[model samples]
Target: MTENDSSAPAPDRAPALPPVADRAAFEAELDALRVREKAHTREGDAIAAARRRLPMVEVDAGLELTGPDGPVTLLDAFEGRRQLIAYYFMWHEGHDAAGQCEGCTWVTNQVRELSFLHSRDITYAVFCQGPYEESRRYREFMGWDMRWYSALPSNNELLTGRQVGSMHIVCYVRDGDRVYETYWTTLRGVEVMDYNYALMDMTVYGRQELWEDSPSGWPQTMDAPPEHPMRTNGRPIPQWSRIEAGRSDDLTPGP
Candidate 1:
């Protein structure tokens, strides 16, 4: 049957499976695939090594940012660490939390731990592209306890010729009182912030996103009724959990 016809009527039921093979033949094919997997892992390591060696650019360390504790310098966000990784969280001015960027939420939600980064003399924080009061409420609503700062007033200085109000992952290095931009990535490059996508890659059906090239009869409804893989109830899939848990989606003006 075709992929569209293969989807089970119920979500709990299994869809379709790949062709069956003899035990020895299956093992032999898997062994060959394992070799390719190892090579892919090695190449990833090589790419990371190359990324580490890229030259950095100096940024104004005195750029202003607003946090829960009020105004702070960009250097201060580093929190006395040797390195800093800041996520440029996109925002919709005056909109409620539900209207915020889904792509940003999808990735940022995975960054729940920072102790490991601290162990490596690194600090991680979010440089939100809106008012601190509104965005921080969204952060609390989503149950994220990470350090967050509003970069709205200083986006020009921080982004420096790049597009502002867009999601970006920027790496920085501290040299005494000076700060330098080591690397910055956006779009698919920022997928590193996603654990769900990484885990989905290991599954048989994969992410089931429309763009993915899956085997015939694969159980993916990408772009059919759902359209995007990240949405379900007219909102990002993650927001549903918060909504179900009775979290407020309001970040509108005046509380």
Candidate 2:
């Protein structure tokens, strides 16, 4: 093993055996698991149906945002498509601003294979919750090139049932050329970004969330600290403005 791997492969070599084995039991178990999972899903589906029927109040106000390409409209954000999902990334510039909302960054990191989401005609992007001029720099510094725009005025429309300033998920469906704010949920909705983590945390496979069924099982990683070199250059990077100005190399997450 090398420094990175820390473990060596077994030196013993054994004759390969035929791979064929009884799979009926395994198949049955997998089928049972699927059925059990579907039961859990049905509850969510029922709630979603009720949420969908909830009356939607229209807002005449429009918001302006800029993407990697340039200035774009809220409707243009749909990119002539149907359906859109936006993550409200809280970005208030500061060094390792936990104020950016750790959960928001966690969800951001968890997103994967969005091309499938696109194939489903779902246009997903991040609507940054801050001044574009301020958030843009941090976005670029973090190398996040997604469709980001400012939360002009305020993001009240997207965060109806959610607490003010809380991390959230706002989903929309575009009809024809117009966009309609469909289902939007905060707190719990962010779980969709966790991929398989939450699902696997049960019984023999417990969730990484704090209250694990098995105390014997190792605890899941709850807080993921910033990875940027703790100390930049010889100076501490205490502000996003400086880091965006090519001073990230000088960042030092407070000692």
Local distance difference test scores for all models: 0.84, 0.59
Error of 2 at 32 (Å): 7.7
The residue-by-residue lDDT of candidate 1 on 4-43, one tens digit each, is: 2323254564668888999999999999999999999999
RMSD (CA, angstroms), candidate 1: 4.4
lDDT at 35, model 2: 97
Query: Per-residue CA lDDT of candidate 2, range 40-143, in tens?
Result: 89988998889878765443224556665656767777766677788887654544433444456656766656788889888778887765665665555555
Q: Where does candidate 2 clash, by residue pair?
A: 83-174, 201-206, 201-207, 202-205, 202-206, 230-252, 232-250, 232-251
lDDT of 2: 0.59
Off by over 4 Å in 1: 1-9, 12-14, 222-228, 253-255
| Per-candidate TM-score against the hidden true structure | 0.91, 0.63
Model 2: residue 16 alpha-carbon error in angstroms: 33
